[model samples]
Target chain A: MEIFDILLTASFWAAAVRIASPLIFATLGELICERAGVLNLGIEGIMVIGAFSGWMAVYLGAPLWAGVGVAMLAGMLFGLLHATLTVPFGLSQHVVGLGVTLLASAVAYFAYRLSLPEVTSPPKIVPFQPVEIPGLSQIPLIGPAFFNQTPLTYLAFVLIAVVSIVLYRTPLGLALRAAGENPASVEAQGLSVTAIRMGAVIVGSGLMAVGGAFLTMSAFSSFFFEMVNGRGWICIALVVFGAWRPGKAALGALLFAAFDALQVRLQQTPLGALVPYQVFLMVPYILSILALVLMSRRAEVPAALMVPFNKGER
Target chain B: MRLEPIPNPSALRSIGLPAGALVLTVIVASALALLAGANPFATLGLILKGAAGSKFALLETLNRATPLIFTGLAIAVAFRAKLWNIGAEAQLYAGAIVTALLGTGILPLPSALLIPVIALAAMLAGALILLGPVLLKTRLGVDEVVTTLLFNFIMLLFVSYLLEGPMKDPMGMGWPKSPALEKAARLPRIVDGLRLHWGFALALLSAVAVWVIQTRTTLGYEIRAVGLNAEAARFAGIPVGRVMVKTALLSGGLAALAGFSEVAGLKGNLTLDLSPGFGYTGIIVAMLALLNPLGVVVSAIFVAGVFVGADSMSRAAGVPTYIADILMATALLTMVLALKLTRTRIRWR
Candidate 1:
């Protein structure tokens, strides 16, 4: 069979959408946070915390929705810690973000080990299975890819539109953009820059935690050490690739997920015998770097991003 | 109450703040221990004893510290210039892979020549890994934080590929690691019958070397000016780009040295789990040392002691060793908090 024949299939597209669901959620979350002029590098750690919490909840016989709720709470709590450190205290964003990642992941790991020391194997929980939409599921090419997916995957797709609308059409969106571009100007307009940023981070982190919950509750059956596996960093890159736009970021996530799915499929073919799997795994990262280089000239990064805002200072 | 940044904090305050931060870290850690159903005081005592209980224990602490000091100095040198080299982990791996390739007698050279050659090759490999990010930042205006961080994932996967394939030890029982280094490539032990290697001395020397260069050199002045404000430094005739590149290269080289030390001093072979986030931990070490080169030695040792002690604590107290990681993270957070508190005047309005 031809390699192209194998690649162009409903199953491949379905896998891509499934894999890309988490990336979409993370990218959208990061997009919201960066639009408010704060770079939250703690996404990786937050996701790990979310995954652990969600898995533990399900293991303890809670409903899947409850597991997701607990994960969001965990993310919000960490987000609050980050905001307390960086927003109010004016601590370095990079330092606080990295510190939070370490702290959250450590706490999660400690909790996991302490709770289940005797479980020699990683404990399993019932995961989210795909649900097919009635009419759309019968379509030919894009049917299963778009219509058949886990509930979290559908939410992730819907959020793309939701985030785009919230970021473009709402008063809150205008304030968020202005805060990122010029906090002083926003403050002059009688809005609290810190409050807006804090809100952005909290909401953004909630979404990121949900993305993480998608990993344990939907994508995989159980939690493992470092299962977030640098996806958070990839999402951070995706935000840049998408030029801080929700629609563009979602597309970037899909593109990466497509490559990821292709790589997995490629590893099972005759071509896999010729090339190492690691080379294939590197496709998304290398492509992102190239894309960043190509787009850096035109990408409209928020001018005040990463700069600490002192409300009263000039 | 709120904080207002002071223009010039006093010398006494700088010294006092870190000590205060350490005390605060202990208190928080104790509170956490109490929650974990362990005696906080006993856990603290075990940590101290585990770190320096015996001659071998001290050596083990130093052994763990050897790589951290290198990575800490790596971060200090770069951060002094406000260049965040988050790819130290990748650069360390690069150095390790290169050193392993050279150390396994791929080149025909004398012991003295081969060891130095291995170190140099490792450093060059490490620096080259970071050089791409620096160039991308300078030319395309790419953010170094994300680019440097991405490189880490790439390098890790590359190393994993190597260990699993070409570099796998065939004679060993299915272990995914490179072949052990020859005696000539190994770093000599400092004391007889101890695991401590010459790498510890090298780490100390590098720290002092970094300190002198940072404080006493024209290049150091340029780097500092660039760090403070690149536009201002450029107006003053300093080549900000050149300083950034130089700082990046030195930072990468130092981080790579940490990888070289791990392979030559302790592991003697490149494994998948080599360094175990030593590069990331280096950031905390550098921060705890307030990004001062000289302070890195003390901070690395302290951080290393925490890790080693925690390992022993796990054995004795039935607590997971990762509790040490929590303490380190807490220490870093409190350190930053303390620095801010000390530098700011509190006011209630």
Candidate 2:
């Protein structure tokens, strides 16, 4: 009864929607990259770059949208590095991805410290305010959560539709799909698999950076160390859970955020008194593993996911 | 551009490329120093001075390298087998938790018997922690990378709970830390009144033992075969799944020793901040070492020295200590590319 009572609250759903925004953007980003046959393990660090750059930009007098753009650009630069190594040089994606994460995170932190030499705490910025759709906001239950949010959150929602369309409806989508599923087939079609895959990674990385920017420019309004904190990894899991489809991945992100929101709310109930808070915090990660086990069986990964393409190779 | 495999690369190719990468990394470092408005050569000198100019600085670098050597070996073993065991951080903490449980006045064995027992228990804990993901990977085809990474977050939360609850130190005033290890259970110092401990000796022994395992053991051959091509290894009558399980156990156990060494040797107690990303740093060490077990020791020392030196340099120069991390990342990327170039020739059309 208490669970039912809590589930009926609009604020809880709003919190869930807010939480899902970042995950949605990041999951779609990773899905795009994996679909193009490169596992951009640099998502974690790209998110860090986004968070720091977005927050710093707004703090330094740039508009909120400009901050998001700066974050995306920074993330794309790292993506270029990841693509250059893994795509043409045929380096190991795993090691290269981890290296990028380290590089991007250190860059953000080093730049932060250098730029703010005497400061003990990071400065705050005025983030994007939530904009409510008048009639939609008046609707019951789902109204406040879905129809009222900062511009970035709305952008995340819009991206889900855009990505699904681009992945399924466009000629570019077909080429991207061919690159991941069978690069040789793509080459036979006279399309360059290298360019398509690299472009996917660069664009996807930009989306991932936007996800991190969502945390700072909309959700938290401040940057902190480890703030990205495995969220990028979680989005990777979400991608698998959704079977690499943008729509399903977005839905998975929403479901994950709902559970996360429920866990936070549960801490205030009678159950919170009985269980350690850490148990609640561990739920999202533990659930990610369980979800992977449950869904991995049904997931059909791209055949050439981690395979490098050489034009003349068999 | 197209890549072609070299007919046979010269033996000197291995050393030359990585050395070139290091030079590039030095250029990157100088570039970073210029950005920070510090003298590049002066900053480099300060790092070297802080790392090994004094006996004390050298001792600190060794102490830092001790845990890294263990974790580096763990990563090297797992990576060579293609297990993608990124949960070394979680496994290390699992080992630390067990060390805390057994070494905090619980075990009644003498100094000689107690230390090994604690270490053994710690390794078992780490092995069992990784066993979950291994089982999942083998049984249901779950990706171990994500699972292992998620486990790190879960393990940290679990440790946080333990430190605040059952393992809380009574003498400490409301701090989240475990009770101190018994003096008899602690690893003895390598010298009289010196900062160095026997953990460094233990780490060196582990590196040598791992090198032997990789070169001289049947298990090592199976791991390499499985890594190179799992289907081929399976077709050759090697149990690919079993090899993976065994590799996980070995890798997880080695990683756990890092936690045991940190708890029972360096810190003498378990705290949340016991590892300053040493598990993650171990990956850099292993890659820098080119996944060679014996080379892990040298790379661990180098990585640890850079970190310690960078911290010292940050105070002297106006540069941030994070420059070392950037340096590490640059080194990893550049070296990996360099390693590839050793065996492959790039031709432009």
Candidate 3:
């Protein structure tokens, strides 16, 4: 292959990975939550809150890592709120999730506005620079495409493996899955279903918040309103598409990211020049529908995905 | 200790449920405002002043409420049939797109004929947009929530495409807006110089129409029965599937009116961000109304007041308009929790 062609292809792949980072993080988080029988619909809102908090922290002279920490703390707080409503209060999971999304969006918007008057130009936080592995950087096409990426991208890939191992290879994983599948049976076996589910929800929300923070800190230097957009919902779809498996969920994210990347690339192509840019933008959503239809016929969702579990219920 | 039986509750007690919920939401939202360093009472006073204190503000509030009332009713209608129609936002856009095309096209009709024709086009467009999800859900057992939500993105993109390409105004100087609708195709205003147009009346009529259908018709009974318990309705020989399909389509059509009203009655041109989450806000409106048709009108107006007030509050208090949204969400959450508390508890056993 020509050098120029190789460079173009490598850049495309790089963009794809960068786009997939947030999705991957969120999907893995959702996988854990779903495995424990709690459906965290507040993922989108949590991500938005994370983006704002992270941006605010970094914009105020805190380290970028500190932003991540603040984002995770915000996510944990939201997760606790959601857990209280759905788990203990036994409110509708779907309604509570929607409410949380609304509340989160409102908080982010207000916070952004409150800070707007003080700064003439929005403060730009430095993004995480690419860290190249010494020996891996010299490898073939894969080296530049995978190893020479931001720290968050590599963290996403590592998380997929870590989550997969934790979900399928450990006793805790078994107990969590059992809690979702049959909380009564799990409780009878001397496990605390509420505790397990709460842990999963908090962890999932924290991971999603980190994903949101990445959007503001790495992908875009300054946070815009609704920066997370619908990526959180996309993560929800990915969990279903991947059938609650971490590795498969990561693949789903990659697939979505690839399409999104292609859409962006197409905007520069001759064919894209003829059509409206909106059509290309719609490609991801259209593909999502097609994927949903295809998956619904074959994919078996968790047996107790949205159903609230009670301790004594058999 | 033995307890005596309680006395009969008054009418106020019954109405107090929703009223109390609304009050509680405001209190919580006010606390949040305090955290933001703004006085909740002062902020709310500004909102009230902006929404209803003056004629112009009231007109703006009505204009905002016009579409919300339609979308809220649309949501409530589908909810009554036990169908989760989250695609109202997309469906509204679909209606707006069709209305824009027809209203701006070279069809030379008088004002009387053009207006109705455009409105019908919007209704049909909305209904058509929702058909895919309706079919998938009723025939294939696909979840409408995901499909509807997904379609919202598609329709939004489609709208963006139209504005950027074929529908882009030639004289817009690179701005992404459609050409203004011909005067004949525009909705006439009832009052001069105010934003309030005939769409408010149309929305009112539609709300009444839905109320009549929901209360006086056999179809409404079937819908209510299905919503209460689908299997039981099916066992009772009610065609639950048909009711779901019809209700979903009706919901889409109603939501479409919101878009049509915005384009024909307000903007007179299609813009990219025509709705700032009006579709999503409709969900809160519907829930706050407890899915009651008449209640939807009152709830929609109240919500609209908040939005109008928020814009002014943002300007005056230097707070983000999103504080209004936070308040709205808090109100909705409280309302839902309160409703759940008042309902008969179900025992899984």
Best by TM-score: 2
Share of true Cα-Cα contacts across chains kept by each model: 0.67, 0.97, 0.65
Q: Per lDDT, what order, best first?
A: 2, 1, 3
> Per-residue CA lDDT of candidate 2, range A175-291, in tens?
999899999999999899999999999999999999999999899978888999999999999999999999898999999999999999999999787999999999999889988
Estimate every model's Cα lDDT from 0 to 1. Answer: 0.88, 0.93, 0.83
Off by over 4 Å in 1: A1-3, B1-3, B8-17, B346-349
Clashes of each: 0, 0, 0
The collision pairs in model 1 are none
List, residue by residue over A1-314, the lDDT tens digit for candidate 3: 23235346877777888899989988888788888887787888999998889888988899988888999899888988887677655676767788888898778877787777666666788878888988886677677778888888888999999888887899888888887787877778877777888888888889988899889888888888757768887788888788778888899888888779877877776767887777887887777777777787777777877777754444
Per-residue lDDT tens digits for candidate 1, residues B3-91, read: 68888989888879888878888997787667778999998889899999988788889999999999999999888888889889999
lDDT of 3 by residue, B1-349 (tens): 1112225544565567667987887787677668768898987788889889998898899989999999999999987776878788998898788888989857789989988988888998898888898888887666677788888888888888788788999999999999999889899898787768999999999999999999999988989999998999999999988888788778999999999999999999889888887888898899888899898999999999999988997788766777788888888887776665454233432
DockQ of each: 0.68, 0.93, 0.45
The DockQ for candidate 3, computed on C-alphas, is 0.45
> Candidate 1: lDDT over CA atoms?
0.88
- Pitting candidate 1 against candidate 2, the one with the higher lDDT is 2
Per-residue error (Å), model 3, residue B266: 1.7
Query: Residue-wise lDDT of candidate 2 within B40-86, one digit each (tens)?
Result: 99999999999998999999999999999999999999999999988
Please, what are the lDDT tens digits per residue for candidate 1 over residues A52-165? Answer: 998899999999999999998999889888877887788888988899889989988988888886677798898999999999998976998989999999999999999999
